[model samples]
Target: MNADEMARELASLGRRVAALEATARPPAVPAMLDQHLDADTVLYAGLGGWDGQTLAWQVVRGWDEIRSAPADASAGVLAALANPTRVRIATELLRRRLTTAELAQRLDQPSPGQLFHHLKELLAAGVVHQPERGTYAVREQHVIPLLSVLCAVLDLRPSVPWEDS
Candidate 1:
């Protein structure tokens, strides 16, 4: 081929390579806020993910609502989990199903009454459900969301250089 034609062909190939690289690169992270929303006003109403025909939704309310809303909402779940006994109950339930008697014995509670008290709180908060007359287990829908909230709150990653070292 002629020298000029060879140069033109190389330039075309370079342009194609650049275009392919741009397409292959991962998408940039979106900015946290939209033009119309500020930190105080911005809220994620839902996070949806689709796989095949199934769609999973994680719902959240606005920041103001989250701050001011009644305890029966999101706050209730956290409050239910705040106690050591309740946390133990949840962790055990996460592993496998257990009856009230089994849970009480496993936890070494003084009485069934005390275990029932914690269980009631868990039930009201929708963290656990009685599958039948006696068995209790963590609600299936709440497992992932609870873990996500805990992870977000705890945020074990080191924030400072010294901490990392």
Candidate 2:
């Protein structure tokens, strides 16, 4: 082959190798909302605010833990979208309250074990809630806030903040 043709062939091979590597590596796992699950966490504390059980209170709670690490907030937000499977599972659970079994069936999988794990992760993230045993629902408080934030980010507005009236 001529030099140009050989170079093109090598480039194509490189692209294929890169694609294979990407598929081989485990996609980065999204961080669970509760990086540090605490008794005071709203997930475990019931939807009620501070006065409920009033369990262990950390010096700085939740997002406050990231005060010094501003970058972590952006990273956390980006990581939240890393797993499509989890997102799909969350969407389904939100739409219809499902037991792990039901979710698995809808997913066309024989067992719901993996779906349950994803649900647990989302639960810790505060994106999903368990109102009763084996029943799961989206936590409107948390989900709405996240959705609003996402909408704000994704919403395409004019480049100029103000328009000529």
Candidate 3:
């Protein structure tokens, strides 16, 4: 083979070796989660806010502890995100901090009062916070947790339509 052809063949062989090495490596077993029957976490690093920072979370709670916790412990947080408008605001905030006017414009919410109303609920629930006077963002520490919750809920799709009783 010519020099160019031989060089291309060598590069392809390197990639195949790398793929084989990756597959040969053992899976990272979440031993703590498996042994304790608890959940792991979601890791996220993104460009967000004016001074962006990586968001990391590793919450591991025993099933019994989770079950025994006060039922209302998360009510405010969940209830705040139950609304369509609030969910939109939250998901947007996850990417970057936004002002009240920006949020309203993006969500097509014409009423400033209405936008504030929803923001208030989110602020109270700890789902979001105002960085300055009016700009809002998902709390830095809560970013991964919030994404985990959204992903888990989104996985609740049914395989087939349910028949009437």
Candidate 4:
């Protein structure tokens, strides 16, 4: 096409793009805890992402109202927990806090190196924290939320005996 025709086509394309952007809805923001929540109240938070064609979500909950972290942060946490070793480490921490050496021993690691590697992943994901030198524990704020996500992923439901219905 000639220059004039090409210029007109580009201008039309820009206008269409501007119109689409103006009409498109902004991404949803996750909920936040407002005030001091009661102990019994269960709060669930979720993160969602869309990539043109596919959309995905992950939900987490706690006994008390908890604010949802950003999508990127939540994804990082899930990615860290996706590993078997990291899940075990987090579970061990749930029972009681332990030092790096104790955790390595309990998990039956031949050396602390491998354990530390997994621990580092957990630490970076914010699922586990080191309060002092050599000690580690699941972040208190993440315990219930992590369990909630696990339960949701597992899709736990009431079981019935074959003849009991």
CA lDDT, every prediction? 0.72, 0.58, 0.76, 0.72
**Alpha-carbon deviation at 28 in model 1, angstroms:** 24
Q: How do the residues 2-120 of candidate 3 rate in per-residue lDDT, one tens digit apiece?
A: 99999999999999999998766434322333434325433323222323543334566666666677878588888998998999999999778899888988999988989999999
What 10-residue stretch in candidate 1 is worst by lDDT?
Answer: 46-55
User: For model 4, how does the per-residue alpha-carbon lDDT over 18-83 read when each residue is reduced to its tens digit?
Assistant: 889865633444334654655656656543332222222334346332455467876898899888
In terms of lDDT, the poorest run of 10 residues in model 4 is 48-57
**Quick one: best TM-score, which candidate?**
3
Question: Which parts of model 1 are misplaced by more than 4 Å?
Answer: 1-72, 156-165
How many backbone overlaps does candidate 2 show?
0
Write the residue-wise lDDT of candidate 1 on 88-162 in tens digits.
898888666799888988899998888999999999989899989899986656555655665565665467749
Query: Candidate 2: minimum summed lDDT over ten consecutive residues — where?
Result: 44-53
TM-score of each: 0.53, 0.42, 0.66, 0.52
lDDT of candidate 1?
Answer: 0.72
Better candidate number, 1 or 3, judged by lDDT: 3
- Residue 90's lDDT within candidate 4 is 87
Better by TM-score, candidate 2 or 1: 1
When sorted by TM-score, best at the front, the candidate numbers are 3, 1, 4, 2
* Model 2: how far residue 11 lies from native, Å: 79
